[model samples]
Target: MSNELDTLLTALYVDLEDRVLPSLGWSRTHRRGRRPALGDAELLCLAVAQQLLGVASERHWIRYARAHLTGMFPQLPGQSGYGKRLRAAGPLIAAVITELARDVDSWHDVLRLVDSTPLPCAASRETVRRSDLAGHAGYGYCASHSRYFWGFRLYLICTA
Candidate 1:
């Protein structure tokens, strides 16, 4: 049987071996030893992949990661762990993505089309109060209503 998580991990590792591992310092010393840090690609893949599984917030990411993602990407630590790794790799990931979007000799930037509608509080209006305006129930926008209100929206953004 093939495990999706294991397969993905193997592919990711292969990528690192080819692109990243060769460029970094991977030594096992007896001193302080290496920190339990997720690689840049690992963190980014975890973040983006969890988002696909319907996780949005950092806390949610942590929880879901512990429950699902970690099972998929065991390198994913707690929420703090994932956040730290992701944050550390933000710049490097951005540069890698930017470079990947372009060819060796491309003068023009590429483009991608992305659109999403805010599914604000479509729930019972009575259920929403000034104090109830917390989280998704809080300030959200109504795309169908073409107005900015308060509530939760499916937040997902990807750069092309």
Candidate 2:
């Protein structure tokens, strides 16, 4: 593997192992909160490995595990279990991602691209009728877009 790829993998694995796994103390030893069947570390590692391999969607993720992750992980957890594990760790995962900052030395020091995107919060018809954005969802109105979009506006940060 290239040095960059190796560094990223090592950083990701170590971050998952040390920072992400410990916060998921949702379950009790006496099973008060109900333990996730899969270990937190295994689930995170498997999901990240899938993401690194560019596998999206839960079904294809299972196929990826059957092909690549199975040999690496003796547990080789099932798709359903993986889904549950991911759900349990969702907030922590997002927090970890948000906390990660770019390493300036690792950067190219050339042109930088900073952008934004729409992260819609389910603006379906019924959703519109029930949401605070109901009045805002229509033609020619988006506070964030500053223009007409057929859907509700969203805000997110992007960087490259």
Candidate 3:
């Protein structure tokens, strides 16, 4: 890894471990079950690095991490294990994101933009019937497309 990436990861890890995690009252030691080989802070850092590096696939990310990030994360989990852990860490990830976003100078800006897009969960009648989103997702019209879609709406709000 380049020096810039190393610096960014180090700073991110410190901020997460010392500030973000503590503020959220989350401590891995307090939780039950076996202590994970990869700590939450490290996992979160890994995720940030993956996104920054534009590695979309978790399996490929794991492979890359194992090859290049062994120094930072000595005991990285396998692809499946990593996926499970990442899923379980959703709340933690959200919290970290909120904290980091709040720290940004633009967070308090008055100018904001909001938009929504259709997230089609199912298409065919049989697929729609079998889909777990049967009740949660419903038919909605898309003004832009001039068509109806069956799924949930994804809204995004951000500062201008």
Candidate 4:
């Protein structure tokens, strides 16, 4: 990993620790159960860093982080564990994004850019029918790409 990337990761962790968690009222015991090797904040930062660097596949991200980012994330879990942690942290991640956008709005930018993308989910029609997302996700067509998609759409509104 480059020094610049390291700096970004450090900054992200700090922001999450200082700003995000407290605002969300999340404590170390918030999700009481089997303790994870990495805390919610650390795992969130790792996942965000992976996306920021454009690492598409979680498996690939885990492998890369295991090889290169052990110093930053000494407790990084294996692929499956990391995937599960990230999935569980979805709400936390969303909360962080909203908080960050609000912070940016207050500190500097009032203008926000909003966009969305289809999050293709169900693997088959059966899955779509049975999945919890059945009511929320549906078949939709994308005009820009001329493609049919089945899933939920994620809209992101952020500071310009």
Q: lDDT per prediction? A: 0.59, 0.60, 0.92, 0.84
Q: Which stretches of candidate 3 lie above 4 Å from their native place?
A: 113-160
What order do you get sorting by lDDT, best first? 3, 4, 2, 1
- Backbone clashes in model 2: 0
CA lDDT for candidate 2:
0.60
- How many collisions per candidate? 8, 0, 0, 0
Give a tens-digit lDDT track for model 2, residues 5-124.
Answer: 446656776766675544434223645566654555556667677777787888888876677545446676677777777887788667655445333443435655554444464445
Q: What does candidate 4 score in Cα RMSD to the true structure? A: 11.1
Per-residue error for 46 in candidate 3, Å, reads: 0.6
lDDT of 4: 0.84
List TM-scores for all candidates, in order.
0.45, 0.48, 0.70, 0.65
Worst ten in a row by lDDT for model 3: 151-160
Question: Considering every candidate listed, which one attains the maximal TM-score?
Answer: 3
Question: Which residue window of length 10 is worst by lDDT in model 4?
Answer: 102-111
